[model samples]
Target: MAPGIIEMLIVGFAVGLTGALAPGPTLVAAINSTLKSGWKAGPLVTLGHAIAEIFMIVFILTGLYVFLGEYSLFVVIVGGIALIVFGALTTLDAKNASVDLSKSPDNAGNPVVAGIVTSASNPYFWIWWFTVGSALLLTAVSGGVIVFLAFIIGHWAADLGWFTLVSTGVHRGRFLLKQREYRILLTACGFFLIGFGIYFLISGMNL
Candidate 1:
């Protein structure tokens, strides 16, 4: 049986939170931007992230549905490979990154642009949309359009909440989150990405 709207929302929120917590370009960007600006950076970046997600949701709900429905395996393979490459690149970048807030600008660039570009470049973002996201979307469609909308709202809420907290904490306690700590976190996230990438590759091969 299909899950109800409430259940769908809960599931969406949980999944979204899980995705958000995972170390990725988006998280790194948020932290870096917040360090330069303030807590407001978090929400601004999230706004861009949310916009990208909204576009993906619409595309999935529309004509992409037919493509995914028919060529599911193809989509998986492509997405999986993309994840692997992205993961490797992310790891390398993190390893060589310099965390120097001293040189950071008061206002680097538009958070919205940062969010959009960061999100658009991240391969794992698309992978999630193609895999877990696609599953949630299918379930939501089964329940109803209202359920789908609920899922989107719940997911985005998680993103906004988590990033807001992160940015706020960083902005308030910048000294606590020093350069070394930031690099460590970035490195950890990079490894996590690589692990997820390997999993995706295997899953794709199996498919």
Candidate 2:
């Protein structure tokens, strides 16, 4: 069952727009990176997010065919533990979330590390794996890899576009600032991260 161009476009548009627009961990990271580190860090962080998504897509595509609907309490428990740890770390960091404006941009590794850690640590990836992600793969069974690839490409492009816009806006607005306000914003972000982590933990436990 080959997918028509219209079907491909629909999936592409739906996935791209929704995924790019959806407010989540990655979006927060992108916004924060732009505000703190400027354009260089923001895009690097976004690339890191893309890497995480690649890993997730690969994991889901390969294993889900066999693991679908098989409840893995162990995985759930592990994820829950991770969430609690992540939440705790975020809460602690909230107190020291200040970014140094004068910090050299030569440290390329920071953005990459930040992006990877931010995306990988997020538990929502697992939920997406089971829901819309799985559906995409299932649809691909009839629609073929072409459709899957198209959707993935579209989704990533949208992510790039969205983050670029955010980065541009932040840079143009000179979102960087003096030390005190920076610290406050960082603390606020940290609080949000902690809150998200706790929510993920609780949701995982309930499931």
Candidate 3:
């Protein structure tokens, strides 16, 4: 059965949150922008990230969908496994995960541009698209365009939500969440990912 809209949203949020928490250039860009541009940097950076994701999907659509359409089950299974692995990692790492809102050097570029450039340049971003992202995206697409859009909306919401909180906290008080709270949040999201991974696994089997 295709996931309901709510389930899709949860899945997207969980998966996207898992990605956003990881240390990466985009995270750096977000932090730096927050330092230079204040709370607006988070949303602005997310807007750029959204653009980059769309651009990547467009690029993947050129010929990738042809193959994906044929081997969607395989893709879903792979995605499920990846999600499980990622979730496990997230859960384990949560114990030590820290959100650093510290100001770096004077290297604050345009928040939007930095989001695009940092994400595009990150190997983790490409690996995600090629592996886990493509799979969940295939599942979303199989459900029809509305579901696909829902997935994207949920994904973007996660990005916007997190960065917004980070920026708000950073701009107002240098750190939005304390280290312990951040770890707890990470652990919760990790478990959410694991659950979604299992859901995807079953969905693939049904297909």
Candidate 4:
């Protein structure tokens, strides 16, 4: 038997958390904003991320779905390769990255806009939407719009939960996430992405 709405939701949440934990521009922005603006930045950034995702979801559902359906294998292969490259780059970046709270911008604009712009500017964001995200949406759609909506909610919930936790911890604990801890966390996330990328590559080849 096929999975139900709950299962899809769980899948969505897992995927979202994985994506959020991965070191990326948006994650950087979230951390930066939080240091400057406090814990409130977390939710605001997520809200903006969600807004950007909403439009992306709609576009994938309506227009990109057709093209993806036609070239599914090719798209998956390219996406998988891209993921591998991204993983490598992330790993390298983690080794050198340092979080200097002292450098936090004093004039960082609205967190919501920061979220939207950061998300939009990232090429990987669109790439994931086209490949992994599109595939996930197709699965969710099998159960109906409501199920798909639930998947979206689950995904955003992970984003919100993670960013909020990070922001709150940074704001409250202040000394919890040192540069070494940050690098370790990002390195772990990079490995995760690499694992996922390998899986995607294998799956694409099988197709």
Candidate 5:
């Protein structure tokens, strides 16, 4: 069955949260900025990330989908495959993932700029847009613009919420997230991604 608008929103948030929790350049930049600045760095950084993604959204929505036309359904298949691969990798890496918030990199620069540069420069970001993001977006658009907007809202919420928590915890020296907890969360998200990938593949083939 095709997922409804609410489902899309929920799925978007879940997937976005998984992405946010992963160790990446953007997250590192946010941590460095938070250690140097304050809790505000997380949201500010996410804002810049959102800014960079706006162009990606425009490109995928206006060009990629339109160009793909009838073959767009295959995007779902590709996205499912990518998700499975990403999930397996995430799960395997979770056992060893360690975040060091104390080691602030001097070159973090402005939190916003770091977010933009790190996100835009990462090759995986584009790959994600071409696969997972595009597939999820196409699924959302199938339900109409309102549904698509819901998905965006959910995704942004996760990004903002996760980063804010990380920054706040770091700035306050709370050190709330330990390695064990982080690994568990990653493992859960990895399994969730795999499950979602299966569902997406089934939906795509049937749709």
Candidate 6:
């Protein structure tokens, strides 16, 4: 591959890995879907997440990229409120976290839908993609469809790898379900998510 292509791929993978591993609705959805269905559901959920990211990136790159500069204050305020609410909810959920494997025959489709909805509905995602993702794509390549597509593939691959590992581990070690320490860990993750949300909100306001 050309040097530009190689660089874009690396950037794609890095962004993908970091974003995929970040604590958020998509991650929670992955965990829930894995437990609800099975390993097979993991990839489908990941695909949905990737699809949402791709859509967001494209939307921002197009003329639809409405610069929120005029509404920065409003956006910041809204984002802050969302973060606080989301964070509190996440912390509460973690406190009472438990897997309910009860599944219906028609529930197979739920994981995919859940993944899509969670990813699409996340306000954080909209902020990140519009601000960061669009910038990356604009700088991805001066010209080359192959290179752009490769970037997308690399990004998606990272998400797929992460979801696969997370679900596989959770499925294999159901013992985490029985351990109080694990519950604490989940709670910590929740707290951290809230912290992250608050940070984002404040950062938005200052911007």
Q: Write the per-residue lDDT of candidate 3 for residues 161-181, one digit (tens) a residue.
A: 988888888888767678888
TM-score-based ranking, best first? 5, 3, 4, 1, 6, 2
Candidate 5: tens digits of C-alpha lDDT, residues 1-207: 545888988988988888888888888888999977799999989998888888899999999789765785688889899888888888898999877776755887899998899999988789888888988887788788888988999998999998998899988987678889989998999998999999888878887
| C-alpha TM-scores of all predictions | 0.67, 0.57, 0.93, 0.74, 0.95, 0.61
* Candidate number achieving the greatest TM-score relative to the actual structure: 5
Clashing pairs in 5: none
Model 5: residue 151 alpha-carbon error in angstroms: 0.9
Better of 3 and 4 by TM-score: 3
lDDT of 6 by residue, 1-207 (tens): 222677667656655665665567776777777777767666888878877776777665564335543554555565456545644655676666654333333443477787889888998778666554554454443337767776777778888887787677667755233546545655655565456457646655554
What is the C-alpha local distance difference test score of each model?
0.70, 0.57, 0.83, 0.77, 0.86, 0.63
Minimum summed lDDT over a 10-residue window in model 5 is located at 67-76
lDDT of 3 at 85: 86
Better of 1 and 6 by TM-score: 1
The 10-residue segment with the lowest total lDDT in model 4: 98-107
- The residue-by-residue lDDT of candidate 4 on 1-207, one tens digit each, is 323688778767766876786666777777788878899999999999999999999898888777666776676676667566766777788898764444466656889999999999999898788766876676577568888888888899999988887778778856366778778877876676677668766755675
List, residue by residue over 70-113, the lDDT tens digit for candidate 1.
76566555655654554465556655554333335444577777
How many clashes in each structure? 0, 0, 0, 0, 0, 0
lDDT of 2 by residue, 39-148 (tens): 76567877898887778878776787556535434444444454345435544654555432333334334666767887788776666545545544444444666777
In model 3, the clashing pairs are: none
